[model samples]
Target: MTDKERLLQYCLRQGDTHIIFGYRLGEWCSKAHILEEDIALTNIALDHMGLGNAWLERAASVDSEKRSPDDLAYRRNEREYYNLLLAEQPNGNYANTIARQFLFDVYSVLYYSELLNSADDTLAGIAGKGLKEVRYHYKHSAQWVVRLGDGTVESHKKIQEAIDDMWRFTEELFEMDETDDIIAKSGVGVDVSGLKEAWKTQVSEVLEKATLSLPDHNLSRTGSKTGVHTEHLGHILAEMQYLPRAYPDAQW
Candidate 1:
């Protein structure tokens, strides 16, 4: 495929990923363990959704597609989604959710940092706007990770379990493919592989400060990059797409 085509596909895939994951995260709004956390989760969810809208609009413009952002987000099938498996993993417990968010926020901050220097002006602009939101998300999640990991015995245990359970899915975040190759070469994106070392350093340092051990288990899961996802995505998509799918062209 041509460079432009590859770039467009990458953008669309990334946008779809954010929308689906954001919709999933929104489910935690009033369901969090505490009021402050609940509001925080929802606010971050809005940020994700907002970024998704920008990316999707750009993707549609690039492809000259007629579908609206809502359509692209809600109408797509599960197999068409490109989000990492970690995002779709069921929010098992408070600690589990925080662990997932912590890791994702780390990667996202790094990803957007590189994107700010993108050769494509639109992508750079979006990244610039997104960096501020992501910075807060990372800080919030990092603080929680530390608290949960270093808190009471029960909290520590739960957070460690979360870290262990979620660790495997992190491999996908740094897994680069042909789409990454095109974008990196074109200066429109960062190489996922290049981000891996820095991500590892940051994550490991946080775990240490939190008094959490690095997961000894070495088995890592992948595949979401190519649209392969876990079973959880089906349910997430069903809930997220219900309004638009059922109502068809209805808008607020």
Candidate 2:
């Protein structure tokens, strides 16, 4: 309701998306077809975890109660999470994972780069570190998208299918609402809606090189802005938060 409340929500939304997507990347550990890629995904996953935690810590700092970052992440129910719908989608296959990663990486690179100018110093600092990390992430995923998309026919088909599957969720990345309205007015938020055209152009160029067709859909997956999410988020939270919830007093 208040500006501070909206900023806290903004931080939480960004934090949730990063943490959830980091966990998704972690799912590839020991599961990637190649060992090098397995390590790469894990490292990226860790980077995401750090980035996520930074935002969560900032969110906690903003909270009147001064909650811990873990308290926010490990204690919240699915409905309380505000991650992008794209971030929480399942990793169906290597192609599927790459497709998902490619899309998000592009957006992440653009998103964080712009956030470098945020009016809030802490958020800008987070963006500075996050920008360096995701730029590498984008390069990695973008190359894979091209390699698979332009490779064998089977590879192309699978990658294309993955793209189509993930395309429906892409729109959620740029949706502006009360949170953005509040935060952007304070100059603490990047106006993501303004990034859509650039995102589309960069995406189109990559798809062109990959020989992949751009997917056009009349509808997109939505609801993340309002704490609405797909069913997968519940399952992810069940595993991720199980330890904290089960052993609230346990000290490791």
On residues 22-135, what C-alpha lDDT tens digit does candidate 1 reach at each position? 776788877888898889989988998899899988776766456666667778888877777888888888888889889989999999999999998999999998899989
lDDT values, one for every candidate: 0.85, 0.93
Per-residue lDDT tens digits for candidate 2, residues 137-234, read 99999999999999999999999999999999989888999779768877899889989999999999999999999987756979988888999999
User: For every model shown, what is its TM-score relative to the native structure?
Assistant: 0.96, 0.98
Could you tell me which 10 consecutive residues in candidate 2 have the lowest summed lDDT? 216-225
Reference-based TM-score, model 2:
0.98
The residue-level lDDT of candidate 2 at 44 comes to: 96
Most accurate candidate by lDDT: 2
Candidate 2 residue pairs in backbone clash: none
